[model samples]
Target: MGQLSRLAGTVRPGGRTARVRAAVLEATQDELVEHGFHGLTMDQVAARAGVGKTTVYRRWGSRAGLVVDLMNELANQSMPHADTGGIEGDLRANALSVLGALTDGRLGATFQAVVAAATCDEQAAEALRAFHLRRLEEWVGVVDLAVKRGELPEGTHAAEMIRAISAPLYYRLVVTREPVTPAVAERSVVRTLAAARAGAFVEPVE
Candidate 1:
């Protein structure tokens, strides 16, 4: 849910279109959480949203399409990347945000469903890639700010650094099937920040 919200595009302040999109997206999340991606269907979402099946199919095309659009809506609702002046503080904030989303029951399940779908479905993989790319683009600004302030090396790969901060948490949440707690988030911060501050994220010369 959070992942989708964070990936969604901008919405007009208020309108029939906006209301419909919100309803459809909310239904999409509910379906994803309860049924996983495999169990999600256009008819189910349409019924849940109280929208016509034709409208759902015409607007979103397929289940994967619905997931992608839901992600875009979610993205649009996400707050801008954190800005704490100090790079360490900013990175911690980023980690906390990811942690919050992963630990959230509905959002976490949605992400897990998508992650599993991506393993077998090309469309799902593409949707996941597109959504995460947008999120990384939004967040790398913090690292860029750090570099400009001399907190990080000039050639630091900001997006990669941000990815590093989130990787372990996801791994724990999805791979090892371990608990994703505040302690895990904090460890990710310390580990990623230490390596980043040591220039591990600096881009190599071409």
Candidate 2:
């Protein structure tokens, strides 16, 4: 989703500008992990980043802008779709990737803070929405490959297949407040592939 990039009012830059963005976003995440969205402030980020407050305000405009760019940066840094030569292996890799991210201390805390903020803040909600959508789009390619290889139903919904693999893990992490163990991630892959083989993810003709 390019919505957040548009909201930030700039495309990716280079040289000094890129450095400034990197510093400011790092500061933003540090603040989010320690103080959360409510406690985050433009002035504090500027100070933490060692940049001028005016520069921070001019570049990002608001706390939401900083978060938008940070999420974009993370998305850019995320691993691409796995190619393990089969649907099962690829989906297993996807599940493990989700597990790693959710279990990572700093990254997990950053996401939790944003998810909490999204409930009450429209801008934060947009950032969170954009982040997940970008990830989903990137991972959909693996499903496409599986279909071409006849490993899945011809009309299977690729995005749905990807979502199914992660949804249970997220439910455990955010809803049930239970541990999202590797076993849980493995179960998701096994179950989703079974359902997929049974045509559970096929799209209906309107």
Candidate 3:
């Protein structure tokens, strides 16, 4: 699966520890995509990974612990903010990246599983929160650069602007159950950019 490769951390020759971690994470993602978080179990993950149950438990402690590490790995692999010499292009690039991940079969299912789990699981929710927070921080750089270039307001909240670009796409993906297409992603960037240019994202002076 395309998602499996992304979840598999980099490997090194003779790196047994890295290999074990990669196997466990790959198995964890496969289980999440097929069975979801509610159905996920440490034993199943261990069995699927071909690692000992004791090794799984000793390393992850519990299903939530596994999810936390998995989320962190995914976050670390996220692409850095695009710089296309203009905010619009960068925002469109960002929006399309979100659309691509949410539309991907295995990756999308994995995220949906985590999101559903987060609805009632505090640990899952925290993991999801941290994952998005890291992504948001990474992409906010484009907005900050745009402001410095006089393309956006002087005090535009970079993080807020970046969030605005992705919010509508996510709403369609999770809330409205609507199709998240390239057109939709483009519209989000356009609307968010227009608002940012109008100072809608500017932080209020206290």
Candidate 4:
């Protein structure tokens, strides 16, 4: 099996253990946001979590391991897509949800900083990719529903449509350094839905 499979298998199953793991992961995310990846230390995480260094080390093994777990936890906690009964309404809800996440006072700056650091760190990049994949899966469900409802063209790539909806928001957050307001998110969803309706994402014949 692959590394991820192995990691999945190793995750502790149950109540108290799961709670402790979650607490530690939350502490790690806060530390990483306050002090970049390079500056983050296991000792600091233990201190913030009110746990001992030995507990953290025994549980996670290293800083990278802790970060990987944190990313996985975040992915698991990501909001699910809304089924609003129409492509436009679904996309609108989806876009607004993303905007809310990006602009959330506690998670926004942390996510932005982590994404920037991921560009230079292989481990961070992998974790970030996993988080995005989870998010894409959520959005794809909405697109799939639209296809079933005859709102989208046949063979439309829901994953690609999700990327289109999010691209501008990420660009604004990372490049343009602008706020990901509801207006911006609504416009993106409208444009992407319009294009998808127009067959902009139709797959070419093999």
Steric overlap count per candidate: 14, 0, 0, 0
Ten-residue region with minimum lDDT total, candidate 3: 1-10
Candidate 4 Cα errors over 4 Å, as ranges: 1-15
Q: In angstroms, give how far residue 96 of model 4 lies from its true place.
A: 0.7
Over 61-143, each residue of candidate 3 has an lDDT whose tens digit, in order, gives 99999999898888877777787999989998898888888898878888888998999999999999999899888888888
TM-score of each: 0.91, 0.91, 0.95, 0.88
* Candidate 1 lDDT by residue in tens digits, 1-206: 13333222444577777767877888898999999999999999999989999988999999989888866666666557887889888888888888888887878888898898899888888888887888888899989998899888889998899899999999998899999988888888899888988889999997
lDDT of 3: 0.86
Candidate 3 Cα deviation (angstroms), residue 176: 1.7
lDDT per residue for candidate 2 within 1-206, as digits (tens), equals 11121112333566778778877888898899899989999999999989999999998999988888888787777778888899899999999998888877777778888888888989889888888888999889989898999999889999988999989987887778899999999999999999999999999989
Ranking by lDDT: 3, 2, 1, 4
lDDT of model number 4: 0.77
Q: What residue pairs are clashing in model 2?
A: none
Best by lDDT: 3
Alpha carbon lDDT of residue 123, candidate 1? 84
Candidate 4 clash pair list: none
Model 4: lDDT of residue 141: 84
Model 2, residue 25: displacement in angstroms?
0.5
Candidates' C-alpha lDDT: 0.83, 0.84, 0.86, 0.77
